[model samples]
Target chain A: MKNYVLNNLPERTEKPRPFGVTMAMDKGLSVREVEDLMSIASGYIDVMKLGWATSYVTPNLEAKLAAYREAGVPTYFGGTLFEAFIIRNQFDDYRRVLDKYKMTYAEVSDGSIELDHDKKCEYIRLLSEQVTVLSEVGSKDAEKIIPPYKWIKLMNDELQAGAWKVIGEAREGGNVGLFRSSGEVREGLVEEILTQVPFEKIIWEAPQKSQQVFFIKLLGANVNLGNIAPHEVIPLETIRLGLRGDTFNHFLNQSK
Target chain B: MKNYVLNNLPERTEKPRPFGVTMAMDKGLSVREVEDLMSIASGYIDVMKLGWATSYVTPNLEAKLAAYREAGVPTYFGGTLFEAFIIRNQFDDYRRVLDKYKMTYAEVSDGSIELDHDKKCEYIRLLSEQVTVLSEVGSKDAEKIIPPYKWIKLMNDELQAGAWKVIGEAREGGNVGLFRSSGEVREGLVEEILTQVPFEKIIWEAPQKSQQVFFIKLLGANVNLGNIAPHEVIPLETIRLGLRGDTFNHFLNQSK
Candidate 1:
């Protein structure tokens, strides 16, 4: 409504754009909730991921998908679900489940399991043939640290294996994977990875405000951010636009 | 639907009952979002609080309140709004705002501003005549630590001043007022406050999962909890019922 006016706010990328993608993590939000979320923040949101194995326990899964679909937001089952299926030797069933749900995107991740690197890439290739694949690189275990070189190698290999985009894992809490237990970003690792990988193709999993601010300040307004909570979508948009206090001065002096 | 069954779950007090109240914080939720949240978790939510001057800026304020009202959930502006009004010598205008919004509950707090304790009590008494008063008893500043005796005195005074209930301030992030910067509860302060004030008459603002688990375990299933996020309402209900892993073993050995 533009009830109150401000000047020179940072510009954000519109929908169907390659970069500036916002992927929200849905931890069992109801059908109505998804519809409500889409109604308000769909313009800011690029994709929705049903977090972890929540899609397995979440009721009315099809209805939730329909809500997002109607809003023109693509939905995907979380990588944990993929891991759950793979761990149970139900990879074929997982593929069929994707077709059953009419999913346009699929996430291939080894966050929860120890899988052979080639097998992970193979899964990405197979999934990419059927649906757009977003392969995540990083461990969910807080103690397990993957070196910058390894992170770059995996991201490159996954992208080479038909991954439309690679995800930098930070989990939903913004702790572990790209961040320390205290939620501090491993700046060296991130910088090193960016050196070898394209910035636009890596969606950083930043669920915390500080993490979101860090990425926005480091990568400008159009950084691809993932794993946002449903409610924080608008707040994150403001942060991206430098309307929030955290990034208020960030985009102020910069020429657009 | 009881899709999965478990034995020895905790029994929770139903709505229209005192205690066990779950007051969710609506930090500028759209009307559709409110309706969506209520549709799924109305049974778990006892009230909704418009957080910290956000009601002043939130669009569709009346319609959002209507959504909660239609779902049989009462809504109140946050104490910060009350402080904002009082600090500006607009207490009458604040009262008028309550009437204008058809608010059934009002919060009296001085978490942000410095107010004499007697004056704070007077506001509580005055607001009590108009709506149910939920007086908050802590500072928003992390460095400002109110002694246990002061918390006890403030809570007791507010209750005597006709407050329907008292709320412990833990800001939205659960990092101040009754909690340390690390998000750990002030165990001694909370323990002392419980000695003088009945647990049923106090709502602890616990936005973090671990804090929610702490209160649920200490106060049992029917503990009054406030400042919960919209999406966490269902998850909080599960915690109260021992359905979540955090409190899964807490209520296991307890007798209903």
Candidate 2:
């Protein structure tokens, strides 16, 4: 297939892609709806996050997971689900459920609740042996702000404990975490963290077009981005390859 | 059976509704995607506009039109499409195809191209005898500024020529039609237009949340709004009924 994306301007590979990974958050999509979305846009998707605790509210879990898996999309529950299990002291039960569903990926985060660094590292270490762990930095609400240095330290610790990637949370609106109320990225904090952690090992959750463009411009076209909305996948891919006006002008300016 | 919309605040009757009509802009969503969206959200949608010349590029028109028809969503090609046909002198063929799809709505617009006031009124008169023509006011692009008085006059003329509703074009972005580039409603234009046109007979295409909130706040909760995206239909209802944060406080303040 002459590469599904038009004109290999920046030429990104298909799945198992090192960068330009688009992670869609399924907040409340039904199995049939998701199947439809994946059938049409699965080529652009790398991972599917069953957004927050929405997966638990749904009637069928196995069927939803199965649909994504059949489409060759890696499926995993949101970190909040993992936190919910941990707070209930059902860590083993969580692992068993994940195994039952054949989910090879897991998300570890202390976004909604609190967890000690030692305990967090221990859980990461425990989960590292069985599945790929995605450790998250930042909180769900503004009441909590993990200092840039502390966030970097935790990212290093989680990676050492065997996290496949550390995600910087921008939530659904891409405003509450890492970004200011206006959705402008905190460039200083970003730079401070990048100095400590490799950019390739972190999936920056950029839910807005401006955020996606910002990250792509700041960290190059192949930056690992996450929390992309379903409809925005193709548009984002076009931006990555300079097919859209925003990035087209961006690359145009860069060449000069 | 329970009302399709929960709580039914500001309670709108399903189709053939006198007030609180929701018009969605198709914007080239695929056949299956539209079906899935309508299955979940069509209760809030009455009219669907295929948005500009997008219908021309969409390959599977019959299947898409059938899906909308099956859902009782009256689908019409946008005024821009009408303007395109009129520009090419293909009104006969356009009407033929619209009848083939059983489309009951015709959008008469001079958004992209120019048609003299008399010629525009003539087209409205021609289409009105056959289809429920929805005439639109304002230019599609920013540079083609129609002064507030001219817009009001044109709106009045179209309605007099028998338009079911005179839509104030906000386009998809909710900018550059009665709105400024900043997406703020031009209050002076709104006031002048409102003085001339009946509010109930107008469908203001308030696509953005801020614009939706503005119209709801200014024109009361039951203002007929159009060009609402599929996902935003429920959210718009929430704002209209004062269920969401933006309008909740406004309604609460008014009650006191």
Candidate 3:
């Protein structure tokens, strides 16, 4: 465990890191799976998002939540769950569920539903008062493209509404937001977003290896990334540290 | 545990299944991780393939192997590792390592190396004399297109040489061998192979959801699948049983 194999790799900002954070997506991992992930790869991850409605369907939700908390990884229900509650007109019930779980982080998103931008920000402000809020900006549908300027405005508004961090939504498939159908990043949109938003405040949901490589190469190893699959946690850390082939020469070339 | 929401789903041929099998790709998973996967999703998995060259990198591999064995899920080193030893004239050392861990299954593949068809079959025959040999056919490179006839010949030859199962070589990425660069299965090639090869003796490497769906729809729910990521075992099972949206209508429509 103390081996120096990662000696030449870039130093990631330490845990409790504002940037260089990884948010792993747990659609519905069993309680034992969470314990196992923590044992093997929690050091590489900062937060866990129970992906799209899994919190609703999964049994032993409390035990799963306790596992993540015991591991010191903050866990949040997926934004789709928030949207589900909002659409059902049961925001109070959702709030009660949050309180019951003692959740410290909550996601506010309008990805799967139609909501006024101002209304979404209002919900963010309300949730931010109770707990740390991470709001997502992007449609879940690949066909519903939000322009770069619109994206920037919404992200800024969400942050101003007191979101701890704004998550740039790319659904778990890694092709819905900030990416083309081919899973290629939209360069111009990304560049525009960078100019308007601080890198430390945006968690780009990169669920694929190529996307992880793209962000690490562009933003250094410290870029905040989200929506990473559980098994990919160690592999993503390897990519970030330049231990993997995709970024093997990244840190070495940086010194030159 | 006995919710049985998949009641209307396709009936999977239960374990000791001749076809409905899921082979998880375990590249360097730690001992605790293997244990965790076994606890959470072992019911969904049948075999564990320690991915290419990872057996060389993982420490406590014996412990990891033992965990899988204790869970009754057979484990095997990837075909690439076999080639690494063969090329180095260290095949005996490799076999000893296999014995050290009491491996019941071992993969023999030439996808990443230049082993003549006859020589590859010889290896299969030799290994099959001791343990169950799973031989993989076709090249790993997407650019290296092996003809349909060649695929049929190699698969037939390997099985004839005593391979328990002839694996159609699509790497864990599912973008090479039997699939296109876009991860689409080559329907014509697959159909041709099916004509020449027996269904029960073939394990298709369908790592992606779409690929799993494709095979399940075409070959029925009991198609043997391999290279499934660890976290995807349950999801893959859900897909097979038509519990997920993608396959929800598949079984229902079939019954009609």
TM-score to true structure, per model: 0.62, 0.63, 0.63
Question: Candidate 3 residues A163-182, lDDT tens each?
Answer: 98999888778887899988
Instruction: Order the candidates by lDDT, highest first.
Output: 1, 3, 2
Which sections of candidate 1 miss by over 4 Å?
A1-24, A28-49, A52-62, A68-170, A177-179, A184-256, B1-9, B56-60, B84-93, B141-143, B217-222, B231-256
Given candidate 2, what's the lDDT at residue B132? Answer: 92
Candidates 1 and 2 compared by lDDT, better number: 1
- Residue-level lDDT of model 1, residues A1-256, one tens digit each, is 4458788877777789789999998876878777778889988889998776555445566788889998999989888668756755778888888888899999999876789999999999889889999999998777788888999999999999999999999887788899998999989999998999999999999999999999999999999999999999999988988888999888986855
- Considering the true interface contacts (CA pairs under 8 Å between chains A and B), give the fraction that model 3 also has: 0.08
- Model 3 lDDT tens row, B100-119: 87889999998878888888
Select the stronger candidate by lDDT from 1 and 3.
Answer: 1
Q: What is the Cα-based TM-score of model 1?
A: 0.62
| Candidate 1 clashing pairs, residues 3+ apart or interchain | none
**DockQ for each model:** 0.08, 0.07, 0.08
**Residue pairs with backbone overlap in model 3:** A20-A222
